[model samples]
Target: MIKNFKWLLLVSLSFVACNNDDNTTVVEEPVSSGTASFTKYVALGDSFAAGYSDGALFKKGQEGSYVNIVAQQFATAGGGDFKIPFTSDNFGGLLLGGNVIAGVRLYFNGAGPAPVSGTPTTEVSTKITGPFNNLGIPGAKSYHLVAPGYGNVAGVASGKANPYFARFATSSGTTVLADALVQAPTFFSLWIGGNDVLGYATSGGVGVNQTGNLDPATYGGNDITDPNVFASVYSSLVTNLTANGAKGVVANLPYVNTLPYFTTVPYNPVPLTAEVAAQLNAGYAAYNGGLQYAAANGLITAAEATKRTVKFVAGSNAVVVVDSYLTNLAAYGIPSYRQATAEDLPVLTSRTFIGTLVNGNPAAVNGVSVPLADQWILTKDEIAEVKVATDAYNVTIKAIADAKGLAFVDTKVIMTQLSSGGIVSNSFTLTSAYVTGGAFSLDGIHPSPRGYALIANAFTAAINAKYSSTLKPVDLSQYSILYPAIIQ
Candidate 1:
């Protein structure tokens, strides 16, 4: 009886030990800061870095910026606070003194993008106190970063200062670089040069390609930045940021042509019935006759005349466009008119104007009869110029990043992937399709919140590879593709 009792006690003790082992918690390895320091992070660039989405800089957009998203990941690995200059409300746009300068944010009203009905209360004159982390200014070019008086509120009206920068600059005379340097950032990210060419592209090539021009002050708001100027300004920015032994990540500019803003609208968007097509062809009969006459008279080549000839079909037809690159036949009372081809890219804003009647006259259709002006479409030549400038800027960016020993994100490659086919991130495939792509916001240029998350992962991956860090990427599913009209 004693031996049996002892055996039962031993069995009970063993069972208790097994139960305790089952309930024990396993410890996880803490996230590491890796070789680089992220105590003070500063992001420098244009609208993308500022988190400007749906066509405006608002509170929620700023929060969803890739900079803030990366900063959040950095927090787990010893990164400090990342301060952002938040707008007054989710309603974007700005007020200069008492007047509205910029427009409100765009939201999809089931059918298409429309402005959110509300007046923006964020005044540019009302400055925010800073040493803020994000130093991104919308509409800023490469040279604007180092230009003095770029943040002066008084200079906003004269185009001397950026209104976005004006709201957060430490003083009236402080440069963006100067303000950033004051913080002595341990880490940083620079993604400028987009706005430099973006203005030229978005304006449908109305701006000059200032390739040989070095003076930025003499350049127009829509001019493509000179490669030399970009190189010099970019190098200076990287040098100053790293002067204090700071490590950072830099991204190369993507070709703006790949964004949905340029790709969404088809060149042959005009659909016409057989009767309407015949009428349109009749309207262009005189122009086609002029081309034939020019070709026969040796005023223009046969191939050139054929290329310039306009004809409409029963189905979808290409819109007429003013191609300035064509030979000037104004001496013969002929305009430089030609039908648009697949190579041409129409600006997104042209969609609203393309099918509309001029002065409510059904016979005088804008795109079909009146012809689209140069400001409405980016011709093939214009696209070539933009590509050349973009490629040059990217080369400089990569070289400078390599020289500075910074982690590099090839946004160009990422954009190409998104434009062609699609890219899968965390089981979700994202494309460059306008509204349903799940990658771009309603503006068609800036990335959606999920798109920003993808970019953050890219930055983190680059940082991890360069610094040997184990930073985990955020789940892309958590982000929304579009912001609601009303924020709760």
Candidate 2:
């Protein structure tokens, strides 16, 4: 009886094992590329493409450029040699035919920002002949890339040439786009038009918007390029890059105001003692009284006058300002005066002057009784202008991507994410904050090595998805956050 019972148990166990095997699920590995290729890759863009970090384009920065990172990944998938117009040192600046056209990189000396102590070693006259892979110019705009003689060393003196390009142009009169086309790439990536709106934003709207002006020559260094001009230039670029039937990836611009360079300094940065606050308010009494009087006289609305009223408290408070938008009331013995609101963003440079005494008055600081100048603040209206232009440019870019059937990387989305909730990659969180954020460098405008790695991953994903390629994404955690000054 015992033997029979054991036999039954064994039989039941065998039946259960067979059922488990039949119900087992199989998981297939992710699919890679079907027809995509990265035989010869080229990158065309501005400073970000050149790896201009910490406000300088040095050797290490160039090596860590997002394009370079992408190219390195391409190498694993049968990509060819990739080259850059590498500067001699990691200190950035370049000598244009023996003159300093760009400034040195910035570093933290445990105090504030200071220029890296070194003479530039990259000479513009020393040309690196190509078919080069990394064709990024540090300061090139959308139109500048297609403009003839933009890389001519002789044109540098006349402000028609980019110093960064002069260092590596195949010939004196070649445009950046033409030079890039000469490479005959199998895969390409473009990230232009940033400087189109960046200049206006960085200049605190000191430059013209040039909204209706189609001529690129008439635009100032800080002016915003017309969206039509951007469209024409951008279309020309895509048409030429794709002329060879090469697949490519393109990235849209991020709102410049979201960068640490503009957002680092808060609007309400002023902290005053009760006594100092009272004294400062007393000094503004005349201006406040004038505003109220104007409101009563119908010179300005009572609500506007109230909105422009200056007030200070012992704790954190917004600094008063003389905005350019205010109506000139000097004829009425009233100067257009107002206090800065939460919407205002003081330029990063304003931090140096905010606490400084105005005309040697300790009690009256620059941001206090003196009021910050229009150039130091990005007013709410100016921000609106930036937004409009950004939107228009992105529209043009997306349209081009759709028409060309190329991969598109939405940088603005990721940038906003980085600035707000931050992004986690490989269990590491990276923000858009300067220095410590491990995303942006000391300059706050450009990204650090890790940040570039993140961008490279974005490009890789887009390329893999659009072209049906299996190119692996770069591991962000492997890249260094920031390079040391000494580079030991």
Candidate 3:
């Protein structure tokens, strides 16, 4: 009887195992190309599209770029080999005639961002052959894309050509648009125009705002491109890209002021004791007295004098800065020196130089005693200039995208979200806070690897929505927030 019972139990167990196997059969949703084609995909843009992170472009960074991420997803549908003009080594930067033209990549050093110890190996003069797909060049503005000889190796030393593009450009005279056209891409992506105003913002508004200047040749490297010029160049680029019936995606510029490079350093970062504060106040007593004299003499109003007063408190105090916008009393020997305010934005590089002693003198501090230069801070007026140009460029981008019926990504909204409360993706919450934020890279200007993943998802969603494609979004957990100092 016991043997019979054992046999029956074994049979029941086998029956349960068979049922479980049948129930556990998994099925995946088939990927579809939909109305779009990925037969020949080409990407054109600036550093962000090139996957530049930690202040430089390297092998890993290029691999993690949003353009590569989108192309990877497209592979499941009909995407072919997406080639990238890769650098020689993971240590970024560039070499021209065996000399370092650009600096190496930055990595976290347990405290903050620091450049890796090594020389770059990628030689700009050593050209790579291409009908390459990824045509994103670092430091490319809207007009640079359509400019001839933009990749000429000889022009690199003269600042007339981009070294990144020079590495892979087909011919010295071939335009970025012409190269893309030669490939005859079935699909494309364009995210240019960030560098248009980025240089001005990053330089703390030292660059001019050439809003009415129609000639790009006359524009400085740090100058903001005129909105009309951006619009004209953008329209031309799109017209050529879609001339042969190629579908593409385009992104608008974000307010560069919101980036960590401009927002990381606080305007008031000086902490002083009572004695120290008193000493500093005494040192500025003459300047304060001069301001009062100017007001009483009718050279300036009481309010204007008060606004220009340089005072320090016992605890935390704002740094003194030279504001060019202030009334010039230079003829009377009163400089435009004033204490920084909340409205002022300090550049990231200012953090290291703020409290340091100048010439090793205890009384001569950079931010306190020696006022910071205009290049170290962006005044409220300068911020407004950047906003106006950015707003104008975005408007032009949106109108062009609508008229061309292309996929559009509003990166301005994305950046605003990052600055405000952060965005939730999958199980992670990404913010714009530096280092720990997990969004921006060590450079504070570019996005981290995970940040690039977020951007890729944004681009893919736009593409899927516009083209009716079923491309899958990448899992954010796969990408890292920061690159380690030693890459193994």
Candidate 4:
């Protein structure tokens, strides 16, 4: 009887020990910080920084913004809370005073892109109270961030101020930089100057490339900003932001043409049959004959005549064109006509404009016969102009990063890798292949949520290297690739 009682006691003790093991809590691996303070993080930039996706800024985009992602990681590394000026709804609309200032977000509506139904729930007149973390304003240029009256609500209607800035500016006449400075940020991310070059490229180089001009006010909305002007404004911005001994990160501009927006459309998209091609060539025969005549008469050099020659073929071909820059060759009846070359870039919006009938003639398609205007094309010269400005801006940014002992995020190299082959992150690959690439949103220029997460990781790595912070990188799989076609 004593031996049986001892066996029962042993069994009960083993069962109790097993029950205790089942109830034990497993502690998660904690993220550590070497010595970085992210108590207040502020992000400053243009559309890309503002979480603008699907051609608009909305709640979901703001929620998944790279800055927000960084803030979350910062929390793990002894950082504090992060806040953003979130738009009211996922529809991405905005109202000012009482009028609709911006339209709703774009969604793929089975057939094509269209705005979601309903007006914006957020009203700009009812401004949210201040000291928000993310201060990115869409349509802001390098100079605009420092320009006074940039946030004046009264100036919104007159084009004197940016509507996006006006929506969240603390006062009527405060500049974006001023508001950012007021926050006394411990860490900041400055990604301005993209618009300085993007405006010219996206406008098909129609706007003036104000390369030599240092005055920004003289520049138009689509004009390429003067690199010197960008440097001056950017330097002043950094100097003021870092005067209080704050550490931050700065990023150089990416090659804008690499995104799907510019690469998706081919330069020579027009195709024609043998007979149709012959007919099209015949139509330009007069211009071709005139070029030869001009070369014979020596009115223009032989090289000039050849360069301006217009030709066509059966399969795929480019259209002939005339612009303000053709050497006034009306004497030879050349009409400054020349076929678009491979170096030209068509605007993404041209997808709809191409292949339409010209003058109601089916055989004479628009792209086949009616040449696209300068606004629809970026000539090789225009692309070169953009490159020069971008290079100069990058140099300035690098110099600033070095001088201020800040982290330099080489966005150009990152984008190049994304465009060339593919970037691998956490076992997933990302590319710059338009909507299907999983990196870019439907807008083709901005990154999707997952893409933004990848960017956040890059920034975190840069921060960790420069500031000795132990911020854990975000898992790319957690963020979304694309929003649903139609949200509930």
Every candidate's CA RMSD: 4.0, 4.9, 4.5, 5.1
lDDT of candidate model 1 versus the reference: 0.91
Task: lDDT for model 2, please.
Answer: 0.83
Better of 3 and 4 by TM-score: 3
Pairs with backbone N, CA or C atoms under 3 Å apart (clashes), candidate 2: 33-469, 33-470
Q: In model 2, which runs have C-alpha deviations exceeding 4 angstroms?
A: 1-33, 208-219
lDDT of 3 by residue, 122-190 (tens): 999999989789999888898889999888898887677889999999999999999999999999999
List candidate 4 segments past 4 Å from native: 1-29, 110-112, 208-219, 323-326, 330-333
Give all candidates' CA lDDT scores: 0.91, 0.83, 0.90, 0.81
| Per-model TM against the reference | 0.93, 0.90, 0.93, 0.89
How much does candidate 2 score in TM-score?
A: 0.90
RMSD of 4: 5.1
List the lowest-lDDT window of 10 residues for candidate 4.
Answer: 210-219
lDDT of 3 at 102: 84
Q: Give the TM-score comparing model 1 with the true structure, all chains together.
A: 0.93
* Residue-level lDDT tens digits of model 4 in 1-488: 99999999999999999988999877866776555578878888888788898888998898888888888888887777777888878888778777787788877666766777877877876778776788889888899988888877777666677777777888888888888899888888998888888878887887753332123343356787888999999999999989987789889988877887888778888887899888877877777788888889878788878888767778988765555466787754557667777887787877788888877787666666666777777777788899999999999999999999999888898899889897999888899987767898877788999999988888889998998877888889998778875565
What lDDT is obtained when candidate 3 is compared to the true structure? Answer: 0.90
Residue clash pairs of candidate 4 = none
